[model samples]
Target: GPPRGRELEVARLVRQLARERIHNVVFTAADVHYAAAHYYDPTRAQFRDFEPFWEFVAGPIHAGTSAPLPMDNTFGPQVVFSKGAPPGQTLSPLAGLQFFGQLDVDSRSRTLTVQLKDASGQAIYRHTLQARRA
Candidate 1:
């Protein structure tokens, strides 16, 4: 996601989803060689009806990890959490800082837990989202 790369397209799609009463949406992605959590709050935006959702960035797996990507403010994105290479580390996929993300869902509780971890599966960050059934 290039900040606001496809602003109009994303906005249009989100609006459609909201119109269908689908509010529990979370956009999970990878390939940016970093990990971060973002929240898109509709209250701060022009489109007031869109439901708030999260966009989770995870992975590169064995590839080198880099710094976190910048957020696009078109959707009023807020950085909830972010983790990247240690201070002074260079940005490269071959930096031996491979990472990955996992999601654990508990249907009974209606909760989704996201974890960002290193090669050893040691979690670097964790977030839990509670879903509201329509």
Candidate 2:
């Protein structure tokens, strides 16, 4: 959720979806100074690999220190909680997901449409959201 374009936005969206499902989380650990992230995978009904999506977020981590200083390698993001909610109610972690796809809304129909594509402009995901007026 740095100062990068679309990254933070996608993070926010992802966070919202997670919240809708009542999930808590940490964040992507860029260095060796952060706690691990956590999320429960509904599809598998178990814990799954948690990683932050970034420009470098998606790929390998390259650690380079000063000409004289040595550094340790990182293994990417970690998921702390895989299942079950904690006792009582608690505030949720921040969701910093911004979608990389096109989003459209129909005001009259109260419907939302999302179109997703891969890096090569191939369609990957498409979803439509509609609500009946109460």
Candidate 3:
């Protein structure tokens, strides 16, 4: 969501991926300084065709940290889980809010599980999604 030359490019790519029959699409990025989970449902949006997908964000492994940004909801994403450092608290290992994310893909089971964890490896949130049938 950072200053990309054309923001529409992101949506175009997402549409292409969906049109190509891609499933379980997920996006991850660092340096956002927070941890949160969101799900995008095409049925809930004005523009249709894109399939539902999940977005998990985790970051600030050691650098400066901040709170999770408010959801834009342009893509009809529902906030599944979200955690942020309290006001006046620095997001870091010492603050016990610094976090990371893990993604497990089981081809045999056709399942994907995402987890966000703290420095001690305790899960703050977990989500499992199964691939839809053709």
Candidate 4:
């Protein structure tokens, strides 16, 4: 679901349901090279939220996908789980991680755990936050 593309339709559907059911969805490495997306749920009468998946195939190359360190980076909010964004900027670095890892969603509690890791599957950091109601 490349934020606005028809990429990985099946995976997008699975991730979409995970968000709706309030379950924990892991950032599994699918077939996509690098993928991110903004999901618009028709049921909620508005765009629900976004879920970004990092494949780890080329994670250590981009700034958004780079390893997050306490000193060598500027940390910000997890943008992959947002509903939508400003006009013409759905694919910005602020929208999704340029690197990759896993996105965990708790539908019952509306919680999301963003786990970032290096290319070798080493844990780097996590950002947990409550999801906004639609």
Residue-pair clashes per candidate: 1, 10, 0, 8
TM-score of each: 0.83, 0.27, 0.83, 0.29
lDDT of each: 0.77, 0.32, 0.76, 0.41
Q: Candidates sorted by lDDT, descending order?
A: 1, 3, 4, 2
Model 3: per-residue Cα lDDT over 1-134, one tens digit each: 32144646867887898889887678876657778888888776554557888889887787666766666545667888888876565655667677899999999999989999987899999988898876
Q: Can you tell me which runs of candidate 2 are displaced by over 4 Å? A: 1-99, 132-134
TM-score quality measure for candidate 1: 0.83
Clashing pairs in 3: none
**Candidate 2 Cα lDDT to native:** 0.32
- Local error of candidate 3 at 25, Å? 1.2
| Candidate with best lDDT | 1
Q: Quote the lDDT for 51 in model 1.
A: 84
**In terms of TM-score, which candidate is stronger, 2 or 4?**
4
Candidate 2 has a TM-score of 0.27
Which whole-number lDDT from 0 to 100 does residue 83 have in model 1? 75
